[model samples]
Target: MRVIKVVFLFLLIIGVLVLSFLRPDDYLWLSFILALFSIVFLLIRFERRKMEARELVLLAILASIAAVGRIPFASIPSVQPTTFVIMMSGYVFGAESGFIIGSVAALASNMILGQGPWTLWQMVAWGLVGYSAGLMQKTKLMNTTWGRIIFGIIWGFLFGWIMNIWGLFAFTQGGNAVNMKSLLTYFAGSALFDSMHALSNVFFLIVFGNNWLKILTRFKRKYGLLE
Candidate 1:
């Protein structure tokens, strides 16, 4: 059921993009409206309604870090600190917070580079990464540093696949089939970079996640959040 929802949501976004291409003057507004509503609805449904001021501030900081990490955008596949930070934040915070942070990071970063549909796709991709990271909370695996390292590898592959899909959309504009060569190149380049990013995330998690969790727990206790 969850998978179905994800598929439908993805297709809906693709449909909106197609509509934008066919009639940018008329459908662009429609696309924007749909995207806005979708994001709002998702945030409300999947996340806590009354997030604390401190959490919001942390989210903003994570987004800013992500944005800044994307400097020198033309470098193809490189080590992206934003991905690690956002994923870790989401794992520690919550899925909703993670999604917001990742999306904001992508959107803000692209503003510095330039704006386009690519930005939107990247935002969606990173947001999903954070969202999925949150699901790890359900499993007891997320409680341990080794578990996070394993999850980070999985996260890296997942991010690489999503980014490759986004690259196909951006490069081919959905006109041609994503050929093997392109797929291979994307995986070889992006997977390598993402794996490194994931390893870095593992290191960060080992070094900082427990301490951050302790701090957030204290804050939560003070505010009576999640008991």
Candidate 2:
């Protein structure tokens, strides 16, 4: 299981790197295919382990909540609870399941928000947020309030940076090579939204952190899932 996990994660990383160079209007579709396959393949391996229907339903519910959480905040720019929810899900469930929920949430939300090449990056970004949190499940960072707040704050900017990759590719057309000024400028332009996202993450974590943790932890214990 660990070996398979490494392999698919490698593929996903390669996909992201490839996207940096590929034209979003042209070849990003290929990167999306790569990421999609990684997710499905990893999920297939996970499901083959004599998993229960309850586990599947739990995952689906988490993904749905994350997706729906994005809608009400759609009018508020970068202030949304989706990232916080996905991060919490990953933190409680462990890495692979966290990745699954994050990826599914992105795909589900984009179905309503409208999908494009950008959706792939959103999956990558949010999935990483969850995966990283799960990786810290055994660490002090995942245990302390300040540490969890820091985690949320960091991912807020990261999620924005990941999405910005799509923006860089999509707008830089006409066969023009991407340059440093363009990269810096693009990121600078998005600083406000990213900061808002980061702040919102902190806000959500402060308000809902303990309660959400208890709820998920209770579910995990009661269902005997993801243990």
Candidate 3:
């Protein structure tokens, strides 16, 4: 069952990428929405099987904290602590918890900021960041403060890059397939904003990364969650 879920997720990502390029312009939004919901459904199903009641509640609280972390940074474009919270949650809990927190935080924040197709992309991108962090939790790289800071920097850029895909497709000329030129142009236009995000992520991680991890880890131990 686990293998099947993993295969499904892999194929879903491939399918979404292929369809994004191949699907007709008129149907692009619809296709993306469908794909987004499909992925969410699968993730929820997978999580439901492994998570207990207490774990679910804890996930909700952490996700709320992550989402709320973005509020104070609203004045500063492209800068927020959402990523730090998600990464710390993943580092302390596990990949599944990270994925849930990332997904939930995106949804929750968008609810206040406004929702659209872009929300889906943000959820997936952030979720991937958290998931990757969780996967690296046991490694020496994630175990060190410097390594964690470096990881934050990498993910900040990566998240921006992934989110930029929505811009690429949204602005493409009707019926024109997204190409290298369009992709590069989009990325170039958003380079500054992405850089700010990357820098802010590094700042947050450097300043608060260890403290956040310790708090979450201590809480996890106290409650025996996700053990």
Candidate 4:
């Protein structure tokens, strides 16, 4: 099952990239559908595995916390605690839980902020962020404070880049084929916002990341959840 999931994810990534370059217009809906399908499939697989109820409840609470974390930062453009929360969850839990939290947090928050096509992209991008963090949870790089800070900084830009794809498709040339010029222009335009996001992530990770991870780890240990 794990192998199948990996293969499917790889294929999905390839498909999205191909569609983005070849048919940027169509890529919007297609990528959205693919992401939705992937989430559903993962949920189904998780259910089939009979995940523990305690774990499910823990994930729900963590996801809710992550979603709510975005609300307090509404005044600050391009800055939010959602990424830090999700990353910390991924750091403590496994990849599947991290992905679930990231995806769910985006959807939950959008319910209040209003939803559009961009919501799907946000879901996938944030989901990948958590998923990647979880995959590296035990690695030497993730084991160190500076390494985790570096990871957060990189993901900040990566999230922005992924979100920019949607902007390019939606606002540029009325959804035309993606080209070098449009891609460059879109990124250049959003560079400042992305930089702010990256810096904010680094700040949060440096200040609170270890403490958050410790708290979550304690909770997990106390409850015997996600073991």
TM-score of each: 0.72, 0.88, 0.83, 0.84
Candidate 2 RMSD to the real structure: 2.7
CA displacement after TM-score superposition, residue 225 of candidate 4 (Å)? 0.8
Candidate 3: tens digits of C-alpha lDDT, residues 1-227: 65575576556656665555555443336444543554474356556566567776888898899999898898998899999889988888877567768877887787798766566667777777777788799999999998988898888889888878766776676327688887788889888888888889889988888788888888889988876
Ranking the candidates on lDDT from highest down gives 2, 4, 3, 1
When summed lDDT is taken over every stretch of 10 residues in candidate 4, the lowest stretch is 23-32
The best candidate in terms of TM-score? 2
Leading candidate by lDDT:
2
lDDT of each: 0.65, 0.82, 0.76, 0.79
Cα lDDT of model 3 overall?
0.76
C-alpha-based local distance difference test score of model 4:
0.79
Instruction: Give per-residue CA lDDT, model 4, range 1-227, as digits (tens).
Output: 77787677667766665555556556446545655665565575566466677877888898899889888887887799899889889888877678878877887887788666666677778888888888899999999999988888888889999989778877766567679988998899888888888888888888898789889999889987776
- Return the lDDT, model 4, position 148: 88
Give per-residue lDDT, candidate 2, residue 204: 92
Q: Please identify model 2 stretches exceeding 4 Å from their true place.
A: 1-4, 16-48
Please tell me which model should have the higher lDDT, number 1 or number 2: 2
Residue 179 CA displacement from its true place in model 3, Å: 3.1
Error of 2 at 152 (Å): 0.5
Give, for candidate 3, the lowest lDDT window spanning 10 residues: 26-35
